[model samples]
Target: MSKKIETDNTCNTSRRNLMKGTGLAVAAMSMIPAATATQAFAQTSEWDKVFPKSDKVDHQKVPFNNRYGITLIADLYLPKNRSGQPLAALAVGGPFGAVKEQSSGLYAQTMAERGFAALAFDPSFTGESGGKPRNVASPDINTEDFSAAVDYLGLQPYIDRQRIGVIGICGWGGMALNAVAVDKRVKAVVATTMYDMTRVMSKGYNDSVTPEQRGEALEQLSHQRWADAEKNMPAYQPPYNELKGGEPQFLVDYHDYYMTPRGYHPRAVNSGNAWTQTTPLSFMNMPILTYIAEISPRPLLLIHGENAHSRYFSETAFAAAAEPKELMIIPNASHTDLYDRMDKIPFDRIADFFGQHLA
Candidate 1:
């Protein structure tokens, strides 16, 4: 376990303390009404991913239902030439606001090259998925999206359901940990470039926000509900994911990946539209990492770039998690660098971790 949550050797005591919660936020979802419930979604026929399709893997767009019944669309990746036997499988998704086409798809495609059945899917209300009122996030349902992927993989004749693993990039990394805490079937989990969206939303960066400030923000979220009611389920503008010009380097990194050609996809929430304004309402009270320690004895790998702005997310999570867990730091890589930088992403190491653990 890491002694401190830091970036560039700077640490914060408040953030570390906040991360060690009593794991009570697991059942806190009845607070918010699930606005965007399950709905019929159209699956596209064209290859709409930002990354090019790989020749070494067989890729397909598929849909599966989460426990919440939300329909999610995912790009399925598998080894092109298999020996007609059950193989270890992996479900990949994340970076919070990002679609599967950008980072998760790349991870899935790469892992498929290393001989695993990988599925990269869009969370509900984003990409080719189904949810009403456009873009939104849910602590409970989003976590279920991972298990739903596992459910789909387990049904496949080529997949070994018992030997299943999962990989989550950026914000989904935190959700991956949350999923493993509840879903014991996930034998191995590798959360790379993690971000606890709830932590960042409720506590600000490094837990800098005061209790008073949190109260004030909640007041605003309270008002937004009235605004949402007034709109009658109309498209609500997102509070985040817009570049207003000349921002910080990390935002620039995200802009480069999401707003530009490198990882731009029309359906991605981060690429153009903003996430819904009420996103913070559920995340503020719910701590996603509370049950992280329970994902023990199962091989857990938390990877992050040494210089990533969000490095502390993985650090704090690693500290809370129990045995058979390892944290791997990618030297000189930033948060978005792991998104699509094949050179920085250790596909070989990730393959080794999943291969050995799932074996």
Candidate 2:
């Protein structure tokens, strides 16, 4: 068994301690109202991804139910001329508010071309997926979303369930780690340009949010629930990825990918819409990577841009996870650069990692 790291280098919050009560959070997550499995979703056949459609892979829209019974919509990608034998599969998601049509889809398609069955799904409540009071985010449900994807992939006749792996990009990277830690069926896992959404929400960027600030934020969220009760609706934030003059470079980079044509898709929450006002509440209390060390014995690979503002999230998580773990820092890449910049995204290295482990 992999023992939890006693200390974290980037932040003082001990995940070892936080994991003590994770069972309660998991139990609470199981209680979040589930929807019917037969829920119908409308999808257009037109090619609408931010990235160009790849001809080397066979792509199709698929829907699968999570344990919460939310129907997640995904695009499945398989190699065009692969053998009849069952092949290794992967479940890909993330960057949080963004949908599968953005970075995750691109990753899935590229990996499919490299001879893996890849499913890129929009996490529950986002994109074409089925969840009420839409655009809500959850540390637990989102983590479960990845495992749900694994379930779907494993059921397919063409997939070798024992050779399954996961690839989480940006914020989904954290979700991927959390899911793999619990879902041992996964043989290997990789996170690229990762962000720990819970860490960022709870502690703020770089753990800069003081304890008083955290308390104040939680208090505001608690009170906001009453207003939501009165309105019978959850309020949403203002349109995300909007840049006023003089924003930070990383924000500008995000705007470039999400708001601009470079990576925008109409259905993506981060593109032009907003998340529920209280979306941060669940994440603030639940540290998703609390049991990251438990993923050991399953190879874990974390990729991050050397200059990304969120690099510390990966570094912190890397410190917490046990061996057979590796942290790969890409030279001269920014956070968003890995989103769609094929030249900057290390697909070959990722393929090699999965190939070796899933073999």
Q: Pick the candidate with the highest TM-score.
A: 2
Pairs that collide, model 2: none
Tens digits of per-residue lDDT for model 1 on 66-122?
Answer: 888888888999899878889999999897878887899989998998999999999
Candidate 1 positional error at 358, Å: 0.7
> What lDDT does candidate 1 reach at residue 103?
90
Each model's lDDT comes to 0.79, 0.82
- Compute the lDDT of residue 54 as modeled in candidate 2: 85
Residue 352, candidate 2: how far off, in angstroms?
Answer: 0.4
Query: What value of lDDT does candidate 2 attain over all alpha carbons?
Result: 0.82
